[model samples]
Structure formats: structure tokens, C-alpha cells
Target: MSSRLALPPWLRVAAAMFAVGWGANQFAAMLLVYRDEDGFSSEAVTGLFGAYALGLIPALLVFGPISDRVGRRRVMRPVLVLSIAATVVLVVGGHSLAVLLVGRLMAGVASGAAFAPGSAWIKELSADRPGGTGARRAALALSAGFGSGPLVAGAVAQWLPAPTLLPYVPHLVLMALVVPIAWHAPEPAAPAADTSRHGHEVWRVLRGRPFVLGILLTAPWVFGAASTSFATIPTFVDVDVAPVAVTGALCGLTLWTGAFVQPFGKRLGDARLIIAAGLLAATCGLLLGVVVARTDLAWLLPLVAVLLGTAYGLVLVGGLTAIELMAHRDDLATLNAVFYSLTYIGFAAPLLSTLALRAVSPTALMAIGAAVALLTIPAALASRVSPRR
Candidate 1:
């Protein structure tokens, strides 16, 4: 398969993107394992979940401009190596919290470093493809990787032996295969004419109102709501009805829905409206979650997943569109880094929700989430109506 597609640079980059995303989320389903076998507190598990973002944010910030200057492959190669190292850490030392933290952190760094440049690479490689199609493909690859990671890990952990160790083996093998492909693929030339200093240009793009408002009002919730659905909801589901496999399936469903619906979001054209509608859908989903928890109707979990997933798709694509429209060509990677750095904050959703749960019932906590989503709607609408700069 590799031989036949040796010249397809986008394929190699897409595969590596998928692997990075998969590695990032592989630990999601294992949060339960940590709670059950290791007796880690919910807070500890959520912190582990957030650790990825902690490492990811810095890497995104640092790597974006570096890739812009040095070209994508140079940045991607080392990050791919870091990705393999992360998996090895998980395979060998997953039992220890400290080790798990290191692994998650490395996974974050890998993701942060690779995602923007890899995405930009895919876009450049697919320049001959129809408008926006490259972006969709990149998003789909990452989403598939993100959604499938936990599902595979959960199923293996539930039915197969060596739950922790085995789940990572496949990813390690995948990384090994893709690393050579990434190295062999052609590197696109960096922009030749930019005279602006990196930090100044990055800051200039970031200070634009459209980009700032779009990211501030919508980007965080895209993953924040997703983390709640994937990381927190599964743990809350009735174990009898929603075992490890079921939980994993739910997480996958949420992500897959998000992935599939993104193209439609691009077609919607109005970023503000898309953001508003997404927040509304997410609000409904969270409110439904409150009902499901109170009524103990686990069957409705799928409905909640759909709503939240749709919201994720709409908000994500919408925000990306806005950023892409706002950014200068040379500064795209840096802009992506800034945008994604804010988005990664959503990884803390599980931890924040768990913390909220201590002071209020699940129902109340979800209600709070719903209200927050509601509040964002007006801001999104306002942003949409605001004159373009």
C-alpha cells in the first residue's frame, strides 16, 4: 500500500495527522481503568486528561512560527518521533500517574507541533483539489483518529488482555510505518517573501477582531463540550447498560458525527450563524444529559451525543473558516497555532465539570453548562452581525 502511494504526499501527512490525533485520545477510555484498577480519584483522571492540553498549548505556540520559517517536514519529523516516544511511555509506564502525565504531555506536544503544519502541508499538497476540500480531508483524518482511538482502546481493554499495553501497540506500529512516509514525502517550500518578524506578525493577526471574537466565543466550547461528552459522560453512564465498549462507542459516535458534519458547516457560509446554532445544539444536548442522568434513561445517551457532536462540527468548521478568511497566507500556521491553543483549553472540561459536580448534582452541573452555552449564542450572533474588518 505504501509503495503504490509513495508519491502522494497528502496521504502520508494525513496518515500522520490521524496517528497523532489517535495517540492524543487513546488515553480517554483508560481514564476509567485508572479509576477502577489504580484507585485514582476522578480529579486525578481529569487532570491526566488536561495534561495533554498543558503540553500541547506551548508546542502549538512555539512550533507554528518555526514551521512557517523552516518548512513543515522539519517540524513534523521530530514531533512524529515524540509521538512514538509518547506511546512507548504509555505502554511501559501507564500504571504510574507520573508516567501517565509524561506520556499525555508528550502526546500533546506531538499533536501541537504536527497539527497546524501537517494541515498546511496537506492543503499545499492538495492545491489542485477543489476549494476547501483539503481542509475537509485534514479535519476528517484528525476526527477519525480522535474518535477511533478511544473506541479501539476501550474494546481492547474490555475484552482483550493487557488493556493498557495492547491498545498502544497498534498506534506505535502505525507511527513506525508513517514516520518513514513522512520523511520520504516531498516538503513544500516556505513562503519566500515575508519580511515581518514572526512574533509581531502573529500578534497582528491575533489582534484582529473577527478572529479574536470567533475564537473567544466559539472555539473553546467546540472541544469543551466534546470532552464532557467523551471523557465525563461515559464515566457517568450506568455500567450495566454502558460498559467500557459502550462508553467507547458513545465517544466515537460524538466525534464521528462531528467529523461527518463539518463539510455541511462550511457550506453554511455564515460563521456567526453556525456558531450560534452550534451553541444552541450543544445547549440542548447538555440539558438532555441532565434529563438522562435524572431519569436514568441511558438509551437517550446517543441523542445527547448527536446533539453535542453536531455542535462540535458546526462550531469547529465555522471557527476555522473565520480564521482562514482572516489570516494572511504566510501567517496561517501561526494563526492556526493561536486558535488551536485556545481550543485546547476545552480539554479541561472534564476536570472543570468534575470539580463542579462536587458542589452540585450532575443535573445542576449540566444545567450550568447549558446556560453557558446559551450565553454564548448572543455573542456569536453579535459577532455575525458585526461588520467585517
Candidate 2:
């Protein structure tokens, strides 16, 4: 909101750090495949995989506001270093699923710490721009980083020697690069006006009406959209809907559409409108997926993938932007953490859908997911599109 918050070179460096940590997104996707390859039980894999969200949610809640007191760089630097540490652990301990889980938990903590404040910082730094360029750039960096993780990891897994080892190896290299940059990154001075607030205030903030509505309208989109690409697309390939390469392509499309297309979504001037449009698009995609899957129309899968992918990108960007606009500037990190918590709730959809697929047709599973998306549309539209207070 202040001119002092204008973008600077150091902000870009911080954004890079934020983006690089998203390699875990790619790792999350590949982990399921890896579990099957390594002969881990589905239950065991699910437990191990869910650790990221478990660690992330609490860290996000605890650390989000801490940055306001201690300073953004203070929180981010250590988290980035920890992320580097987790990458090392990932490579050194790949053979042990237990160690892998710990590394993921560590990575989750680092990401949760960095993501909240980092997003807030981005918006703050970009506050001087005419349009909400800072918000848009922050959204792109976050989405791109998450999106690119799969492409980079998937490519390495597909082509390089030592499929397991190669994917993480690149992350280690990126972490090395992120350290020096994070060290020198500039931050807005911590709120000079410090009021020593006690416990439960954070929870009170989370429980506010708009924030609660934000969670309800946003969660299903997060779960449904992420699962469409990560959970269901691969299954579609297995059922002969399309080739495996298409999965990667669709994943890329989903993320890229979210990252690049979001600038336009911002122009719509209402987060609720953008989210509603995205939900409707995603619903169509999911329903079409059901149709194609049930009818055995393999070629239709890619088209459906495109629809879901684009819709996901739009919803992700709009949802986050809405969160940013909805909260106080100083509260950005906490709000972001809360927003990500909802997203990770959706992130869990894949696991639930995995269990559901055992009992229902994959088509039915996707159709149900589509129905969930449809349900969100009306709620998003009905929600007031007020800018962040």
C-alpha cells in the first residue's frame, strides 16, 4: 500500500527461493508412483505422504504471524536453509521411506514458513504498481514453482540414469543456488509498531466470517483441481485414456495456465467472479472426463485434461489473490498460511480419491469430483467480491 513497497531486485531473489521450494510439489506426485515401485503398502505410503500437510499446517499457523514480529528475512532465511537441508536428506536417504518422510516434513515446514511471509512480502514489495502487479507476480512465481517441479522431476525420472536419484539431485543443486540469494534479499522493516498480543488472536483471525467463507468456497476447488491432474490423469492413462506423456503435458498445462492466465483473471476485478468462472470451467472438464472415461474415448482425455488444467490454474490464482485482498496488509502471511491450509486440504483429495477408486469406477470418481466443483460455483458467485480491507 506504500510506495516504499515497490519492487526491487532483492524481492526477485526471495521469490526465487519461494519458487524453488516447490520442487516438493513434483516430489509429491512422483512419491505415489515411487511407493508402488518400491512395494510400500498404500496405507504406509498415504501416511508418509500426508506428513507434509501435517507439518505444513501447524508451521503455517504458528509461523505466519511470527514473521510480522521477527521480520520476513529472519523467518525466510532459516527456512530456506532448512529446505536445502531437506534436499540433502532426500538424496542421502532415498532408500528409507521413513527418512524420506522426515525430509518431506522438514521441507514442508520450510515451505510453510517461507510461503506465507514470502507471499505477503511479494504483495508488499509490489504495492507501488498501478495494477496489482505485485500480487500477479507473486501468484505467478508461486504457481510456476509448483508447476515446474513436476516437469523437471518427471523429465529427469523419465530420461536420466537412476530414476529415483536423479530427480532430487537437481533440487539439491537449486537449493545451493538459492542460499546466497536469500542471504542478501531485502525485506520491509518489521512492523515498527509492535503490540505484544497474546495467544488465540491468530485463531480468532482465522475464525472471522469472510475468512471462514473463503475456506469453504475455496477448499473444494483446491482439492478437485489438484487431484484432476495429480490423482486422476495418471489413472486415466492406466485405463488407456491417453499416453503417459500426456499426463506430463496436462500437468504442465494445468500449472502454466494458472501462472500465465492469472494476470487476465485479475483484470476481472472480482476474485469471486474469477473463481466462479474457474469452477464452472473445471466442472465441465471433469464431467467431460467422466464421459470420455465411461465411453472409452481415449482421445477425449487430453482435451478434458486441458479443460481441467486451465480451470485449476485460474482458480488457484484467483483464490490466492482473493485471500491477499481479503486480509489486512500486515496479516498477509497468516492469511496466506490459512489459504494454503485449505489448499492442502484439497491436496489430500488425491489420497481420498485413491481409496474411493477401489470401490467406484474412475469415471464415477471424476464425475463426483466434477459435482463437487459444480457445487462451489454458486457459493463463489454468492460471496461478496469485496477487496481486501
Candidate 3:
């Protein structure tokens, strides 16, 4: 079969997004290796975990516009180089903080560059598939990438000779496989005028009830819930399996389950119940975390992963679909960038919860998260009444 026929156009673009996502998240399960084997302090560990966002936010803001003006193919083609560079640095850096940070930052840049363009590209390619097919495709690609990294890395790190170095190899191989597709993915430049009104345009859209009540209120918790499941919960509870392996399994399960649920989320959104359902699931997941934290119940961790995973998938797809329904054609990348930037805010949840654990009990801190999730459901549901014209 021809390469084009073997891999559908949309799936080709999705490959780039997946590879970047794998680079971005492979670090999550390895946090254990960094702490236990590398002898880093808690603050430094948090720094390593949180470093991606510093590079990511600016990339999402800047590269999305560049892609819009130039074309997705132009912008996305170079990110794989950065992704490979990041992994190589990670392999060579060993225990050096500066090297690790640089590696993560490079991965963040690749992900940021890939996400906006990839999201826009896949959606355009999938235009004929179905209403929410694009959103589901994007989410599934990203979630699968995110899940696979930690899953493979955790297992490799547990059994392999060099825990840190060997785990990143598979991602390099994955990226190489997707290079042809990313380079040739079909997105012709639309050539809209770049204007000075970007900040204003972002604010205008952010101010709208549809975004404020619907997406803004719910989007952050997508990552927030996922991070809580794999990152926060594992910190407090003891699992009987191999340490890094268990952590990686939880991380993988959470995101993989999220990936599988994208279609279900799309269905809920089409029924007009997605926002409420997604937020409610997040709230309940947090509440369940509180219970698990209080009881130290390792057995329930998988359940926690499932619930939050479902929430993550639902909120992610819902937010994307919401943007698709509301944004103008020219505004798609910018709006997606904005929505994505918001979601990364939730990436801070695990760090924040860790810092807070010094003073507040884990259960109490998690209850607060549940409360926050509960508060957003109504706002998100109400926002559906008004969409940008």
C-alpha cells in the first residue's frame, strides 16, 4: 500500500503530536528515579517536574501564530529535532540539574510547537470524518503518547542497566518513525495577516461566557486531575510492586484510560452534558483521592486512575470541541493555544499539593481540590448558552 493510504492524513499529523507528548511526559514516572537514585532535594525534584511549563507557555503563545501565518507543516517539521535533542541531552546529563532542566525545556518547546499546529492540522484533515472526530483524534494521540512514555520508561528503568539513559531510547525511535509523516503532513498556508491585536483578541475571547464559564472553568482540571491521580496519590501511598514501575503503571493507566474515553466524551458533549459530567467526574476523583490519602489504600489507586482518566479525556475533548464550535477559521490556532495554555495550569497541581502537604493533611488538601472542581461544573454548564459568533 502507498504510504499515504497506509497512514491516513490526520493520523500522520497526530504522529508528531504523539512523539512530542511522549517526550514531554516520559519524565513523570521517572520522578522516582530522580529522587531515589539521583539524590535530588524535594524542591529540585519539583523544579525538574515543573520545568516544562516555563518553556511551554511561551511556545504555545508564539509558535501558534507563526504556524498560522506560515503553515503548520513549516512550524511542526522542526519540533522533532528538538524532541530528539531533548532526549539525547537527558541521556547524557546524568545527575546534573542544569542538563536535566535544559532537556525538559527542550522537550517543552517541541511539545508547544507541535500542539497548536498539530491540533489545527489534524482537525483540518479530519474535517470530513465527523463533528468531534478531530478533537478526539488530537486527544487520543496526545494521551496515548503521554501514557506510553511513562509506561515504557518505568518498566525499563525498573529492570534496565541505566535507568535514566535507556528509558528515553524508545522515544527517539518513535520520533524517527514519525518523521516522514510530520514532514509531509498536508497543511497549506492560509496566509492571514498577522496583526497587533493578539493580546486583545485573547482577552476578548477569554472574557466571553462560553470560554470563561465553559472551558476556562473546566480545562485546567483536566491535567489537574490526571496529575493528582498519578503524581500526588503515589507520593503518599505505598505500592507493593516495584517502585518506579508502579508509578509508571499508574501514570500510564490514567492517561491511557483518558485516551480511550475520548469518543465517550465527544458523545457526552454532543448530548450537551459533557461539561457538567466532566467536571463532576473530576470533583469525585478528587474526593476519592482524599479518601485514599486518608486511608492509604493502594488497592484503590487503579480506580482513582480510571475516574480521573475519564475526566481528563472528557474535559480535553470537550474544551477542543467547544473551541471548534466557537472560534472563527482564522482564530483556530490562537484559540487552541489559549485553551492549551490554560490546561497546563493544571500541571501545577501536583507541585502545589506537594508544597502544601507540609502544613495541611493530604486529605484536606485533596478535599480543597474536590471543592474547586465542584464549583466549576455549574459555570461550565451555564457557558454553553453563549458561544463566540
RMSD of each: 2.3, 4.0, 2.0
User: How high is the CA lDDT of each candidate model?
Assistant: 0.80, 0.67, 0.83
Query: How many angstroms is residue 60 displaced in model 2 relative to the true structure, after the best TM-score fit?
Result: 1.0
Question: How do the residues 173-292 of candidate 3 rate in per-residue lDDT, one tens digit apiece?
Answer: 998888876777667445565466655766777788788888877878878888889988877788767988998899999999989988777656552367677778888888888889
**lDDT (Cα) of model 2:** 0.67
> Residues 57-123, candidate 1, lDDT per residue (tens digit)?
9999899878878888889988888999998998887679999899999999999998888777787
Comparing 1 and 2 by TM-score, which wins? Answer: 1
What TM-score does prediction 1 earn? Answer: 0.93
Enumerate clash totals for all models, in the order shown: 0, 3, 0
Q: Quick one: ranking by TM-score, best first? A: 3, 1, 2
In candidate 3, the residue pairs with backbone N, CA or C atoms under 3 Å apart (3 or more residues apart, or in different chains) clash, namely none
Candidate 3 worst ten-residue window by lDDT: 266-275
